[model samples]
Target: MTVDKESDKGPYICNGTQSSDPEYTQSSDEVTLTVAEKPEPELTSDLKGAALTGNSVTLYCTLKLQSAGWKFYWSKDTQSRETETETNHYFIRSVSVSDEGQYRCRAGRGNPVYYTHYSDALWVTVSGESPPVSLIINPSRSQHFTADSLSLSCEEQRDSTGWTVKRYTL
Candidate 1:
């Protein structure tokens, strides 16, 4: 490495050329660059939908590898990336069928950035009827103690043909 001064007006300039990096052999002055493979982000969601209309869903993107400082970009159904988030979580406030699509994400960091490959696609679907639905849980609530056994049913106000009572505990 060498430092040169053209004049006193210049702040010190690094006139250094060449690198000690063992990754490449600079042949005939044509510098070839190699990029590492992109990491795949893991996608997870709160509800594995067919979720109800008014509920919100948050999708989380995680890197399986031990790397840091990543910004995420998300894509749905197409290759075009949308929604650049510094954090790994993508939040959808209220979902409709229009929001139903396959989603993927990638992670990138650094100035001349290296990006991980797109993650495995996650599918989200929204289900609703023409008149919509209002669900009621039986035995009107006030606050109850934990571990008390409660048998609740999601009584849909309008539809009976395609209704099921399902409960999930986390």
Candidate 2:
């Protein structure tokens, strides 16, 4: 019996074989399997608005990848230190004033293919221990106070930045 050689066209032909050879076909399929590189991870923080003093804040870093086979890394801007590889989330428990800085993350399988991406710098400001306490007089109690006239003044004991003054009469 004589067997005809397969044409070298299309995916069906493997090493010029008409009959499907398990070894040849299996090896060929293995070669065709593609391992896609994971995309860079996205970094985000749970901090927003003004952080309050003595507040336990969790800074979350999320790693979104095109491929599932990837590990995540987290870091702060002050130092180029990397945290442990997490599959999903990274957190900073009981955040304090000192923990304020920029952060970022990276997604990678191992060496050579690793990539890093930085997130926007978030300024974490801790609120004062007490709300801005201020004393104001609807009508100023000056030495020369005149009747039927309104004079208003504001006195803020605490130092505050970005404060707006308003006067209301009842």
TM-score (all chains, Cα) for each model = 0.55, 0.47
Per-residue lDDT of model 1, residues 23-79, tens digit only: 645434434343334467798889864766766888999997766788988989975
| Ten contiguous residues minimizing lDDT sum, candidate 2 | 1-10
Consecutive 10-residue window with the lowest summed lDDT within model 1: 1-10
Score candidate 2 by lDDT. Answer: 0.56
Residues 90-139, candidate 2: write the lDDT tens digits: 65555567766676666656566556565445556666443354555555
Model 1 misplaced regions, further than 4 Å: 1-37, 129-170
